[model samples]
Target chain A: MQGKTGSESWQEVWDKSVNGPRALIDCWQEIPCDPCQEACAQGSIVLSSGICAPPALHAETCNGCGKCVAICPGMAIFLVDRSIGSGLARVTVPYEMRDEIRLGGEAWAVDGEGNYLAEGRITRVSGAGRPGRTMLLTIEVPEEWALKVRGVRGRRKLLEEPEEVEAIEAVEDFAFCRCEEIDYSRLREIITQGEFRSLPALRRFSRAGLGYCQGRFCQSILRSQFLADCPEEDREVESFRVRAPVRPVKLSRLGGEDG
Target chain B: MSLPCEQLDLLVIGAGPAGLCAAYEAAAVGCRVTIVDENDKAGGQLSKQIHRFFGSSHHGAGKRGIEIAEELFGDCLKLGVDVRLSSSVLGLFSNGEVMIDAPTQLCLVNPGAVIVATGASEKSLAFPGWTLPGVMGAGAAQTLINIHRILPGSRVLMVGSGNVGLIVSYQLLQAGAEVVGVVDTAGSISGYQVHAGRVRREGIPVYLGHRLLSARGSTGLEEVLVEAIEDGTVKRFEADVLCLAVGMSPLCDLAAMRDCRMVYEDALGGLVPWHGADMRTSQSPVYIAGDASGVEEASVAMEEGRIAGISAAEDLGSLNSGEAAERRAAIAKRLDELRAGPHSRGKLAAKERLYAR
Candidate 1:
């Protein structure tokens, strides 16, 4: 439940990252994963209680090779070195986006929550040649912000306007039932007018649930649209009546006729 | 023509991560297993999972889901399990008659023991343009990109910050699409911090406290509108595709039709068939496993399927009760270990409640 790196193990595990390029793992939850432990060649990471336990990082044994960064499924591991320069630090982040990250290029640095902190330069790009592998982007930032910079912004920008092309037009007023083409407005009108207490009653009146999907797609939508506003005491009883032939069956097949 | 009534030793529904493991386990014990799935493929949702799984090596950890699915199905085939793809089970009658709509013909199967591993369905989010062509489920987009190698769109906006949402957002980035952002109504991320961190470190903003207002598009999806849950401020982003990674509902329509007692567990998504620790439903000869029982990790589903298969085999006299109990104990230990994490504590409690009920 702890978001961000907690202070209980931060001083013991992450202080060595300031000395040299060491793995600064922020994994706090007990996830059943051990790829980082297997990925480390120096025996730096240990999962003492099998795979379900949270991994412990042996900072002194970590050589900052960035292998754990690439193999970590959570992308919680980072390599930081405050001793890279006099006042500059280098942080290696696991990058998976298909952006053309140029070496020695200016990139916007981000913190743990993905907030833009400061501009950093991409100093090295590793695992670029390997396909389907997580590449590491090493960024050079201020020495004080080395531990803070966890990631860098990709080059892709959000689209301001989408191209207009008609693929499927709106036939009805937000139809939840695609097969029956019963609009949400129509269902709401029927539910209010008919005073239907159950979903089967509404289905008989509006034919919303009687579709090829057998209400598989629109059942929840119907429940939320109608019963969501009902009184809490009355809300628990209304459920879609599941009948025989749960899936759509051919009339011929139901009649014991072979196809 | 009369419908042929076929007698089956064991029948497993779905053929996904759960059903395949169930069929494999039962067939390994010499219980003539027949697995049926509506899809043409056997692996179900696992075919779309390109990212590696996050369990121990016993469950094929570090291997991609696609690989694990292939290995499971291959093992089932080696055991001579009959995997009928493109087949649907229409109904489960009280007299142990299961009406199946197979690719070839309509038939009735009288299975001595049945494991309903029907899995879960993606829950849809209702918005103005939610029914649009490009506004699709995140799992559908995953299938398109990972299985079919086709990108759903150039720019995408994902709703929900769960594991599926964050993982699909990362996959969308891998498919060369510009993931504009991931918006969720919750103040904090719902999935593991690692998954959220994985997507966040890619510069994909996790817009926590943002609820989707509507999606606007003329014919297809063109723009998405979100509102800040705290201040009610609106934010618009241009996106050709709007992916809904909302939670899933356990598909138990067949089980419900069979008169199996159902329990409503919010933690397990919705109403699920009441089952015990042995995966046996309230009704005799009916067992439920995987997401059909409760939506949890695929690893847990596979373990549950194995237990169900072993229990069914023992009931069918293919395995002795003592051996079945021993095997189930080992699997139960693994299941407990898989659900020991804080992330899975709610699911574990929900499962125990089902057992207690």
Candidate 2:
């Protein structure tokens, strides 16, 4: 998770080695998507729990068709062939950034953390597909760093100097309501005062939702904070009362006077 | 203070993709169409989207949104659709009467048919310091970059991993801004993998399961504190601007005023007017399309606009029932294809529930 050598478990799977071409479904979470399975024309990609499950690839059945590589919405699918050559291996990943890496151009392979890993050359660049707006790029990397190199920086490096985390106190003192100019500390102070019991009382005490835009923006914030402070079992969340003239309107304009 | 009212065959509110398409379709069918939008320009949010759209070629899949908007606007103009820019519909009366505030005068319009395509408004998330001057909506940032040709800030922090957040983060990078990272509370990235891949490859770190706790600054945004939900670890990242792409809610104020049955569907972005297959609301002569009916893609909105427009034209006797049915079927088929993805299952169910009655 720290760097982008895919995930640690994926890295271990890649390190264990395999023969020929294989599709790596780097997706771990059970998201409501299964385009990768549908993209596999060979029936190699399978999911157990309908479309909401992550795809499971059958390495033997996957012929490295690269269809799943092009169709994956998460761009989590990758094709790796360690048996390409003695020292050189091929890795196909989706590239959709603005700066396109032309075929045969020098590709700067980077890890998951955007750190430069090794240099590679773009071997192939595929055209855009249907739903997924990504183009496939096959890069030739060293056999050892094939799995570690997850992406290629098409343009410049976005490496930033590591900054030390300063010990900051009272950092949560910020504005909660943009319309009413209410800060978090102020709202917290009001909450701790214990005078306001209901949302309307809170509104009256702090003027959190009395701005021109009404409570359309701040009411949710007030509710969330109230819930966070008070246990749900102890208090029921109350919504702000809505009135006529829901949206802001000029008095003169309401009078039908032409400007 | 009663003003003289103009009569129209069909009145379209908003000039976005939906409203523009609705106006064009109705006007092409010989219905006297008038489109009213609050903005000075006609292309609503479409003008701000510089990225190419996704879907079939019929929906302008390969073309940029700005180009698509231009094409729609050109069609509306060529078909002689009356466009009222910088005109806001102040109130929508039940009797097909709309009170509008134009630049010059306050006027009223009584139309035989009404189509609401007012679109959606950005939903904000509350964190400490979210109200700071530098913090703004991702749509606002996109507008500033693509439309206004201005960068909101040099170092930006995007909250949300949905398509909007991912796309806007990429756009921010394209506009020469340093995206600190994209943070989302969801365990997995909510947006398309292509968009996420694009931003990830650009070296923008995406922190999943991380919720924005607070934004710390005095006069403006200085830094943002995001806490990982799983471990409760807080990390502060340096960011001048905080872009909230949390979500969007349907702008159903006018629709509600018209007494259209509204439902709070979380999948459809909360508080959307109940509309049917032809985009017609419960109220006769009143139709809803686009995000005003429910938050959806621009492609779906365009199709819904065409369907609503054809329905309105048929109601006005400009288009025959046979022609309207054919057009609606074709558009509905295309719409079904667009919503046939796994990600759109929720939206599909939401649409079903909306039209169940």
Maximum-DockQ candidate: 1
List TM-score per model, in order: 0.87, 0.75
- Candidate 2 off by > 4 Å: A1-107, A111-117, A120-155, A160-208, A219-259
Q: Record all residue pairs in model 1 with backbone atoms less than 3 Å apart, i.e. clashing.
A: none
Cα lDDT, model 1, residue B225: 76
- lDDT for each candidate structure: 0.82, 0.78
Residue B290, model 2: lDDT of 92
What is candidate 1's lDDT per residue for B13-131, written digit by digit as tens? 99999999989889998999999999888887888887778887788776778888999999999999999999999889988899888886788999999999999988886667777
Fnat (0 to 1) per candidate: 0.50, 0.16
Least well predicted 10-residue stretch by lDDT in candidate 2 chain A:
A1-10
TM-score for the first chain in candidate 1 comes to 0.71
Q: What is the TM-score of chain B alone in each candidate?
A: 0.97, 0.98
Please tell me how candidate 2 rates in CAPRI terms.
incorrect
